[model samples]
Target: MRIQWIVSIVSNLVSMGLLVIVMGQYQVLNIQKQREEKLKTEVQRLANEYANDDLSKVTMEKLLADGNKTMTELEAAMAKLSPELEKKRKDVDACQAEKVRSFFQFPKIITLTRQCLFSIFYPIHTNMND
Candidate 1:
């Protein structure tokens, strides 16, 4: 009679452990299902937001055409200004060359001015002595 009671107790304990394991597996599966459902809902919402509209498509094409037209106009304008830009660049270069030449001649100009002043004052002093 004692052996029979021990066997019954062991069987009950094993069944309870198996039940606990099954419950934990079920909770894990339920959590995974909820996550999958949430992801699916989010994906559907994104798809709706980005869905194509005919008016939007036409407007996008029109904008692209306008952008292309503007780019062509800008390129033509730049081409038309090329000669004028070259002329201006040459004029600037000539002005810079003239400035450099004047800078180099500055010392010579100063020496000439000093010689002229000495000549004018020395003659006046000599005539007064005479």
Candidate 2:
């Protein structure tokens, strides 16, 4: 009778251990599932935060307005300087034509003067040396 009772108690303790192990595994799985759900919720929350029309539209509008203002200012500056630029351009063209004429004429004058000097001085030099 003593051995039978001891055997029954030992079997009960083993069965209790198995039961605890099973419950612990189930708890772990439940915790993992809960964590996965929380992560999913957080991702959705962040997605909605950016996907909504909260700041994107306002920022784009502000940027476009600023760009338009800048473009208008740039156009105004160009318009104001348009006449001055035109005058400068005409002056540059006249100056360039004058430069071309002077360049071609100066070289011819220099060559002619050199030839005249050589023709006049060679005889003078030869007579003087003799």
Candidate 3:
């Protein structure tokens, strides 16, 4: 009878330990399921936000077509005005060169003016008496 009582006590303890382990596993699985649900909700929200954006409404092909049209128009304008632009650039360069030449010739111009004034004031006497 004593042996039977000992065996019964050990069996009861083993059953309680298994029950505790099963409860722990159930709690872990419940937490994991909650985290997965939260991730799914976040993904859904991001997808909805992207779908509602203005850029998403415009198609890629349409955007490319508009860009190509603008580029072609700009190229045509540049081709039409290329010769005029080159002529204006040449005029600007000629003006700049003339400005530099005038600056360098300023001293020579003053010296020539002085020589002309002296020659006019001191005329050489052709008659020695008068």
Instruction: By TM-score, rank the candidates, best first.
Output: 2, 1, 3
Q: Across residues 15-60, which tens digit of lDDT does each residue of candidate 3 receive?
A: 8999999999999999999999999999999888888764555676
Models, CA RMSD each: 7.5, 6.5, 5.8
User: RMSD of model 1, in Å?
Assistant: 7.5
Distance (Å) between predicted and true CA of 42, model 2? Answer: 8.1
Summarize candidate 1's per-residue lDDT along 20-91 as a digit string, tens digits: 999999999999999999999999987776675556788899999999999999999999999999999999
Query: lDDT for each of the candidates?
Result: 0.95, 0.97, 0.90
Predicted structure with the largest lDDT when compared to the true one: 2
Tens-digit lDDT track of model 2 for 1-130: 9999999999999999999999999999999999999999999999998777668888899999999999999999999999999999999999999999999899899999999999999999999999
> Candidate 2's error at 87, in angstroms?
1.4
Question: Where does model 3 exceed 4 Å of error?
Answer: 1-36, 49-54, 57-66, 121-130
User: Per-prediction TM-score, please?
Assistant: 0.55, 0.56, 0.49
Sorted by lDDT (best first), the order is: 2, 1, 3
Best by TM-score: 2
